[model samples]
Target: MIILTGVGDVKTAIESLKHGAHDFILKPVNVEELLIAAERALERRELLIERREYQVTLERRVEEATRDLDAAYTKLQDTYRATLEALGSALDTRDVGTQSHSRRVHGYSLSIARTHGVPGHQLEDLEQGVLLHDIGKIGIPDAILLKPGPLTPEEWKIMRTHPEIGKRLIERIPFLRGAVPVVWCHHERWDGTGYPRGLRREAIPLAARIFAVADAFDAMTFDRPYSRAISFAAARTEIHRCAATHFDPAVVATFLSIPESLFEDIRRRSLEP
Candidate 1:
């Protein structure tokens, strides 16, 4: 059956033809014939159907491509995370005392950062920085790194090169460029007395400042070659005493405010056999 469209008083002409007109055409149309017009309209309908089918096929292909791209992206992210974890693990293996140290520091740094209202994007960089803070230690000799006794002034001077080494290492990796400052400056003191570079106060990167407190707290609370683990309260007191001198005061305040249970949990997780 023909369907009439755009008709404007043209139905009268079709009606006058008296050939049981099934549809009408509007102005600017020739009213002299009807069969040829019907054929053309039918052909247009068929063409429209073919065009719609092509569009449906194109849309399906597009959706499939999008899904494939998403899957690839997810895989890439997973691979990158695995690589980072593996690199951290390798560094830990080189220094048995450092096993799980990076992870604990990362957790602590992230907690302090969150408490201090660091933006979400920067928090991610902080976490990574904390994990790799000691990466430069890889460059230190085993005699210096695992020495049972305190370092001599000369040896200490040599040991201080790790941060710069770590910064160099990370600079070579494009994905970790944002974390270079944290690696290089985590050892810097708030009072401008620390090694490598004497960056003081706000001049030090925030991530490094946050990491310093966390790293020191973890080191004091955990068993080390030179000393036994201290109680959490003792550690907290020591951390407070050093605020503004050894660490950023604001970071120390936040660190002190963290519940003891949180430190316990961190210690527990690190102690897992």
Candidate 2:
């Protein structure tokens, strides 16, 4: 940073500065002036070192703060999921003979969605949607939700309202709004015969379309008061039969592509006795 130059060489001094020389002196330098210049340069260097250290300390603090913020957000996300799961599980409490339905359907929905290329946090959103999908059934009387057989026409009308109710309820929570489609439209049919919005084809969100297949598969394979459980192959057959009618054809195809072992393993875990 220190340089020797002619006292009259202003141009050379400027050039040296342009080239990153911090200080310079004349060739016929006074010893005192030269010592002063050297002392000033050393002081400047120390100041620069201090400044760099301060910047490093500031950067480290910022990084620590960012990491803490990320961790807090992660914990908040976990709490959100746990709360939704609890609410979803409460649905099973209202109905008898079917415990862990929400968890089962969540697992099934996740599997189907992943097979359809829904990756990362979108998959988590779908999981949230699955857990909270049945939340609006809280408004329905147990008489309708737990009916051992088919619901009456009047009961069916009320039953269909659950999707809209769920949509309204969940959109109130900003973070959960991303999952509204699965909660509200999972029952939609590919042919537009579904209730509520009756969205057809690509109009339905892929998450909901994927959920429809998962929900149906779980429904058919699991025991209900009106019917006994069916084999995985039988459920798969039913899903294929309804493709493009009750379910998305692409989603159905994806569901079929999944190995039976994956489903069997999920089913084997945490089934209610």
Q: Per-prediction TM-score, please?
A: 0.80, 0.92
Candidate 1 ranges beyond 4 A from true positions: 1-64
- Model 1 agreement with the true structure over 1-273: per-residue lDDT tens digits: 444445556556666446644456654556554566788767877888999999999999999999999999999978876777667767877875667777677677788889888999898688677767778988899999888788999999889999999999899988898788789998899999997889999999998898899889889888877778898899889999999899999989888888989877876776576
TM-score of 2: 0.92
Candidate 2 clash pair list:
none
Candidate 2 lDDT, 187-272, residue by residue in tens: 88899999798788999998899888888888888887887899999999998999889988888898899999998888877475
